[model samples]
Structure formats: C-alpha cells, structure tokens
Target: MLTLPQLRALYPEAPAAHLTAFAAEAARLLPAHGLAANRQRCHFFLAQLGHESGGLQLRTENLAYSAARLMQVWPSRFPTPEAARRLAFSPEALAEAVYGGRMGNDRPGDGYRYRGRGYIQITGRETYRALGRLCGLPLEEEPGLADDPAHAVTIACAYWSWKRLNPLCDAGDYAGLTRRINGGLTGLQDRYGWLERAQRCIPWPEAGSEALPLPRLRAVQRALKARGFYDGSIDGIIGRRSLAAIATLRAELGLPGEGLDAPLLAALAA
Candidate 1:
C-alpha cells in the first residue's frame, strides 16, 4: 500500500495531513474498483489523480479567467476579445456560455451546476448521469458530491473502471490512458513526471516489477545494520531511523551530513 510519507516525499508541496486522509480513503475504496490487484494501475491512478487535482488541493475548476486568457482557453466561445471581456471573471456565466446546450445540459443552469468536479474532474451532465448509473448514485442531480473529498476517490475509481483504464496502465500505455481520461494528451509531461515519482514512492512489495529498483536504499540499510549504527529492520524504507543512521555515519566519516546518495551508500559500505 502507498504510505503517506511516500506521498509527501513525492509531492513535497502537498499538505501532508490531507494526503494522509486521501491515501487512507483511496486504500479503502480503490480495491473494490479493481485498482488494488496491480500496482501499475495504482501508480497511474495516483499520477492522474494527483496531477488533475493539483496534488489533491484543488477540487473546483478555476474558471476565473482574464478576457485575453479566456479567449485563448475557450476560443470557440470567446472568438472575439469583446466576447471574452463580456464573460471575464464571471465563472458561472462563462460555464453556462461554454457548456450550455452541450453534454446533456439542456436547462438554464445545468452547465454551471454540473461543471467539472472530483479529482478527475467529472464534467458534464451526461458524464454525471452515466457515472451515477454505474455507481448507483444520483450524481446528475447532486453533482456537488464530486467536489467533496469523501466521494472524490470513489468517483475517480469508478470513472477509471468505466473506461477500462487498468489494462492500459498494465500495458504502460500512459498516452492512451491520458487520452481516455482527459480526452487528449494534455499535461503529458507532467503526467509522466508524476508517474515516475509514484513509481519511486510505492514500496517494491506493493509495486511489483513496476517499482524502480533503489539498490542504494537496501545496500545502505545492510551496511548500517552490519556496522551497528542502525537498529531498525532492513526494509530499505528511509524512515527517520535510516536517516539518523546515515547522518551519524556521514558525520563520523567527515562527509556532508545532508542527502542520501551514491557517495553516502559507498561510504556506508566502506
């Protein structure tokens, strides 16, 4: 299972407490959605969710845009600068203007009401209805549930399962998975970065072959334990104990007391 410390280490900008809660909930909910069996799916899921949600901080879409920016983002709706200026900073009106008469939004305020929410941004009344039917929830009528963290993970997993994304994840088809989830290859670089960090963070026992081998961590653990400078289990997890032992060993060797790297591993071995 993905630990909170690993998540914090991967995304240092995120709030640790919030990530802890989210990880707990995801652990509880994602298994039923078929994400627990394969760590690749879990890694892809975390990368997509973390990137889309801005490290699990942003829930609602930031529709507040300057006229120029709005024109750039929604060129169809704001073809002219004057049109963009008319809807500038008015999120509700802009949403209605951009999304109305599309995505099964027929009524007056359906667009704004059913706008993107959840970690994966479950957008549109049609999507809400389809996901709602699949999950046995009335998300079309009560779309606000998608914004709440309590329901966000479940909704994301449901959407993933609905799109059959696990197979793409297993095949390492990140581009295809992104297209399926995001409708395009938007944020491709960032998605890959998050995937790389996630692969590093998840433990090997849980991550299987998808885990990037960190031979240094295990080697350091063994070296420190053999030298009587470490007392913790040789788990390769760099917790406080491992860090303390590394610091002590480095100080004793007149080496830099910061950061664990190849040099530090070599020193520990020596």
Candidate 2:
C-alpha cells in the first residue's frame, strides 16, 4: 500500500483531497486488480496513471486548445489555422466536432456528454457502458461519477484488467503498454519519467537488488548536458554530479525545492 508521503512525492502538486482520495483508492483497488502483484507492475501502473491524470491534477479532459495547438494535435481534422481557430477554446464545440461521429458517439450531444473522464479518461458512450457494467456504476447515466477520485481508480483498474495489460508489464514492454493505453507513443518519455520517479519514491522491497532501468535519468542527463549544466557521461546514474546539475537547472528555471518532479521533467522535455 502507498503511504500519504509516497503519494505526495509522486504528485507534489495534487490537491490534498485528491491525494487523500487517490491514496485510499489505490491502496484498496490496486491489489484487487493485480496491479500491486510486484514492484514492476506497481511502478508501471502508477506511472501510467500519473501520466494520464497529469500528476493526479486532472480528472476530465481539457478540450480547450489554442488554434495552433489544435492544428498540431489534430492536423487532419483541423487542417488549417483558420479552421482550428473557429473551434479554439470552445470545449463543447471542439469535443462535438472531433468526437461526435466516432467512438460510438453518433447522437447529437453525445460527444460532449461522453467526453473523456476519469484517471484514464474513459471516453465515448460504449466505453462508459462497458466500464459501467464492469464497475456496477451507472457511468453512462452519470459520467461525472468518473471524476471522483475513488471511481476514477476503479475505472482505471477495470480498464487495465479489460485490456489484459499485466503480461505486457511483466515483459517490460513499456512501449507496447503505452501504445495500448494511449493509442500511440505520445508522451512516452513523460511516462518513463513518471515510472522512474515512482520507482524511487515507492518503497518496493526489491528496490536496490538490481540496477533499475533509467530512461528518465538518461533523458535528464542529456538535457542537462545539452544546457551545459552537466558534463558527466549520460549513463543514467544519478551521482553527485547529476544531483548538482539538477539543482542548478532547477534554480535557473525558478523552480523551488529539490530533486526531480513533474515540473522539472516537463521543463527538461520541453
């Protein structure tokens, strides 16, 4: 089970109520879903959850995009800057335009009605119906229920089980797992960073028995080195040199506190 401190470390910016709710629900539901079967499983599951929920700060999808962002995100749909501008900052319009005719959302208001919600962002009417049946919740009738942290955790766990993602986690197939969850490899590095941070924060019994994967550290090292804050080899080992580099980078970026967090990861990635 994850302690409050552990949850806080994983999501430093999460609200107190959300943190408390997630901690309780994760502790209660993770084991039931076999997500806590091992350190690796727990790390991967929490990492994906953290990434999907934006460090536990978001339950519903934010469809308010700038025109440029909309064009970049859905090039085929928007195609032109003017086309995207028409829908920009209009969440309902954007949702209806982009999601209306797909994902079993054929009815007129079904897109906005069944927009992405929950930790894993369960979108569309069919998904809501399926997860609703599995969780014994009227998610289709009451989509807002998925916004609750407890229900979000339940929906995420059910989605995980329905997707049969444990074998992929067991095989250390992070890319495949991302593809399954995200429908692609978007934010793959961010997911890895979340996993690395979770591996460090969570009190896994087998933690120092072997060298853990360090893709996040490697990416950080590369970023720091590129910015001339670090000169060490990009071997993914966080030694004194890496720590110093991270501290310097954080200070330079006006970010408070110490060590790697979500903000630091985003800055590095950006």
Candidate 3:
C-alpha cells in the first residue's frame, strides 16, 4: 500500500493534506481494480499517473496555452499562429474544437463538459460511459467525480485494468504503454523520470504480500542505521530497540506512526 510519506517524497511540492488523501485513496481503490497485484504494476501505474496528473495535483487537463505552444503541441491541429490564435488561451473553446464530434461526443458542448479528468485523464463521452460501465460507477452522468481523488484513482486503475497494462509494465515496455495511454510518445522522458522515481520509492516485494524476508529486513535495518535512523543491533530481528528506532525515524521524517511499512523500507533503502 502507498503511504503519505511516499507520496510526499514523490511530490514534494504538493500539499500534505492532498498527499494524505491521495495515499488513502490509492490504498483503498487500487486493489479493487487489481492494480495492487504486484510491485511492477504498482510502480508503472504510479509513474504514469504521477506524470499524467502532475503528481496527483492536476485533476483537469490544463488547456490554456499560447498560440506558439498550441502549434508546437498540436502541430497537426494548429499549423501556424494564425491558425492557433483563435483557440489560444481559450481552454473551453479549444476543447470544443478539438474533441467535438469525436469519442461519442456529438452534443453542442460535450467537449468542454467531458474534457479530460482523473489521474489518467479519461477523456470523451464514450470513455466515460465505458469506464462507468466497467467500474460500475456513474461517471458518464457525474463526470465531475473524476476530479475527486477517490474516483480519480478508481478511474485510472479501471483504465489501466481495461488496457491490460500489467504485462507491458512487467515487460518494461514503457514506450508501448505510453503509446497506448497517450496515443504517442509525448513527454516520454518525463515519464521515464517518473518511472525511475517510483522504482526508487517502491522498490521490490512479492505482490499482495507485506511480509519482508529476514535478510531483507536486516538489510533495511542496516540501511536505516546507516542513515542514522536506527542505532541498534542489526540481527535480522525487529526487536524493541529497532521498533523504537523506527518510531523515532518516522517522527523525525514527519511520517505517520505506521512503523516499519513498505514505505519505511523504501525510504531506508534510499
């Protein structure tokens, strides 16, 4: 399960309250969508979601941009500033122009109404409807729920499950997954960076299991001691002293008093 401390480390700029809520929501929702089956799936999902949602800070897609940026990002749609200027700085107008008459959005103002929202930015009326059906939610009727952290995590996990991204994630096919999620290699480097960061934060463990092996536990204790979090014997046993050390470290790091969790192990390793 993800912890607030891990989320805080991943998104240092995000508010602490937001990270707390996001961690709780992730722990609650990810398993239901089968995203907590393994560490690889968790890491890959978090990396992509972290990148897409701007570390769980951006629920709605920011469409506001200069004409030059519009042309650069959507060259096919805006070949020049003369063509892009009308849509520039007008997020709602841009949404209507680009997303209208597509993805089952044939209404007058469906684009702006169904603009991308959620951790993975589930866009379009059809997508919302389909995800609603898949996840047994009222996303189509209440699209704004995507902006809520709880629903955003659920929507992203549902999308990930529907796409069968775990195998690709296990295969380390980030480019392929990126193409599937983004329809192109946009922000590939940033995605890679997020992946690296997630790997560092999550580390390795058996899927769905929280029990750390003895050797691994000893290694973690050693790591903590090296980082001045623990100053006890590293005998592969979590003794009272070790637990006290862990509590002290948690207090020092502003982590919750959840003692010796996967996040602590990851932090110790880092």
Off by over 4 Å in 3: 15-17, 206-270
What order do candidates take by TM-score, descending? Answer: 2, 3, 1
> Residue by residue across 1-270, what tens digits does model 3's lDDT show?
888788788877765656777787886677876667777677778889888888877878878989999987788999988999998999989989989999999898889889889879898999999999987889889998888755666678789988888776654456668888988777766877787788777766664433343466678778878878678877555656777787788887788745566677677873
Residue pairs whose backbone atoms clash in candidate 1: none
Clashing pairs in 2: none
What is each predicted model's overall lDDT from 0 to 1? 0.76, 0.82, 0.78
Candidate 1 least-lDDT 10 residues: 207-216
Candidate 1 lDDT by residue in tens digits, 28-51: 777887787887778889888878
Whole-model lDDT, model 1: 0.76
Ranking by lDDT: 2, 3, 1
- Report the lDDT of model 1 for residue 213: 33
Instruction: Tell me how far the alpha carbon of residue 116 in candidate 1 is from the true structure, in angstroms, after superposition.
Output: 0.9
Q: Pairing residues by index, what is the TM-score of model 1?
A: 0.68
Off by over 4 Å in 1: 10-20, 75-83, 206-270
Instruction: In model 2, state the lDDT of residue 143.
Output: 87
TM-score of each: 0.68, 0.75, 0.72
